[model samples]
Target: MTNTEITIHTDGSCLGNPGRGGWAATLRRYEGGKEVKKRSINGGVKHTTNNRMEMTAAIQGLKKIKKGEKAQITVYSDSRLLIQGMTDWHHKWQTNGWRKAGGKPVENRDLWEELLTVTDELNVQWEWVRGHAGDRRNEEVDAMAADAAYKAA
Candidate 1:
């Protein structure tokens, strides 16, 4: 298993509550002047949340890499809430049996747990990107996600 570092961009969109939603992830690896781009999408769901889409993007991206290969991935997303929850509050939630403080069940616990499992399989470094503000790759992913959501509707 060769160790390769992949720069990945991800985005997700939801049309309305219990409405259409989608998530897209793009993986790019540059060798000299050549860049390989691979995209994946998840849709076809009747009811979903934007957070679920966001988490799905990350999970799908991680799912692409082969096992036992060292992957250094930088995942870009505009969702600060998702990033913080994964890097910060997840520990507390797990210790508390996936419940938040005050003993309330956490939102999207299933997706969060799934994401954690997929991410743990690889070496991922999560980063933040401002959505719809002209980052070309991120914008492309945003378009893909929106289209996927609409198509699934």
Candidate 2:
């Protein structure tokens, strides 16, 4: 609401590829390049994929923006699939009726659609960060997600 841009860092963790999973998002608002506000949210499920948790983190993070608050958002994640899908691949998939180039249904169509809906409500930019590369915020969310996954398990 203050016209200050908000940045969100998100991560997801799974015990196994298709095992208990968790996701986390940390949001920050900066003014004059100084962080003025911060909040974190996390959740987990007994059965899910890392990809699903990754998308969930982004969706839940974006949802934290208050309604009617029009602020530019930049989302950072280590998941290339999440970032690339949202920034590039989703358009083609949508145009092709949610099917991949090979005529196979997009694996996470539901989450993709939900992400699109949430993103449409705001101005968003996607950024990819390498996981475990020492980015402080990224590392924080990574730990948060891992802890959540363990708790869920």
- Name the best candidate (by TM-score): 2
- TM match of model 1 to true structure: 0.87
- The alpha-carbon lDDT assigned to residue 139 of candidate 2 equals 98
Q: What would the C-alpha RMSD of candidate 1 be, to one decimal place?
A: 2.4
C-alpha RMSD by candidate, in order: 2.4, 1.6
Residue clash pairs of candidate 2: none
In order, what lDDT does every prediction score? Answer: 0.80, 0.94
True-vs-predicted CA distance for residue 34, candidate 1, Å: 6.5
On residues 1-153, what C-alpha lDDT tens digit does candidate 2 reach at each position? 335789999999999999999999999998766789999999999999999999999999999887656677899999999999998999999999999999999998999999988887688999999999999999999999999999995
- Cα error of candidate 2 at position 94, Å: 0.7
lDDT of 1 by residue, 1-153 (tens): 434567778888888965788888888764443565555555545678888888888878777866654656788899897778877989999999999999999998988888888777677788889998999988988998888889884
